[model samples]
Target: MKYQTKIIEKPADTLTPVGVYLRIRDQFPESLLLESSDYNSDKNSFTFIVAGLLENFKIDKGVLSVNHQKKSIENTETVKNALKDFIAQIHVRQPDKTKQFNGLYGYTGFEAVKYFEDIRFESKPQKDAIPELNYGFYRFIVAINHFNDNMIILENIPDGETSQIESFKNLVTAQKVPQFHFKANNDETS
Candidate 1:
């Protein structure tokens, strides 16, 4: 079985375990069941949440796990250690970076761009209307930007490569289409 993972490194103060878990679940809807367990034998208690996603209704599966108590730490050192362990497990899974990035950007409706210094066309398909031209891998620069309250910028996408920038842009733009706005009401009883 092949799976990928990523270690989240945000500070404990800013960590949101439930939010992360929910996001992961939403991304992998095929997951039928999610489980959380707590182990306590020594002085410390450890809580782990795991979710499984089914693929092809067969062997392919996706699993995500997180330490539920790690987000409640006040001591920086303890938090760091807990986060390290959590990250270690994530890396062990080795999640797909590109797919993860696409999922994140897609959800946020942010475009990511990569610039290619040099790009060349290997072969050009015959065009019935337009003349076909071929270049031996020419270099080009690509930039992806998003229009939202928060903007995300990715630069230097190489040629012959497809990315989620277009899809993200389209989703975002569609959501922002002209819509009805509600007015706020004021009360003067006090």
Candidate 2:
């Protein structure tokens, strides 16, 4: 995988973690933001704003999506094995780990208990419910360093596209908050 990395240094208190997240939430689909609540704690450090989705795997539903292409997950394969295969397909060759971070963020919960442990908290997929394991394949992420107050936009440019980098830079460097069109964050203060 190829990488196009951009580093932005910001003045302390100029850019709140939520402020950074809001800028891209509307622009990117399947975006997620995470922040540390306590700045003083070492265990809870740094803010991660994950944007863009290259691929998604909804494990519980037995579905895999690559560039919108869908396929059924194998029943015989263990979840871990399926995950390894999925990662191998999209991220077969690991990128250089020299960067601060490079990998997808995911959680294993609820139904996953059946896979690793004998315990059963599992159930069939229901309408409008969270999946057991939903993993996304992202080429990059915005990593904020809480201690130093630096925001870095990281990207793995598999296709060598620089346009998205420029857009991401704009998203992070906007000087002013956009006026809330629907009356939230507006002067009306309803």
- Of the candidates shown, which would achieve the greatest TM-score relative to the real structure? 2
Using alpha carbons, what is the TM-score of model 2?
Answer: 0.73
User: Model 2: residues >4 Å from true position, as ranges?
Assistant: 1-12, 41-44, 60-76, 91-98, 122-126, 179-190
Model 2 clash count equals 0
Writing each residue's lDDT as its tens digit, candidate 2 over 45-122 gives 678888887666665554544445666644435556756766676533333541445566666666655554555453
lDDT scores of the candidates, listed in order:
0.25, 0.63
Clashing pairs in 2: none
lDDT at position 167, candidate 2 = 69
lDDT of 1 at 15: 22
In Å, residue 157's CA in model 1 sits off its true spot by 22
Each model's TM-score? 0.23, 0.73
Candidate 1's residue-wise lDDT over 83-167, tens digit each? 3454343222233432322111101101100011122333433343221111111011111111111222121123334444444
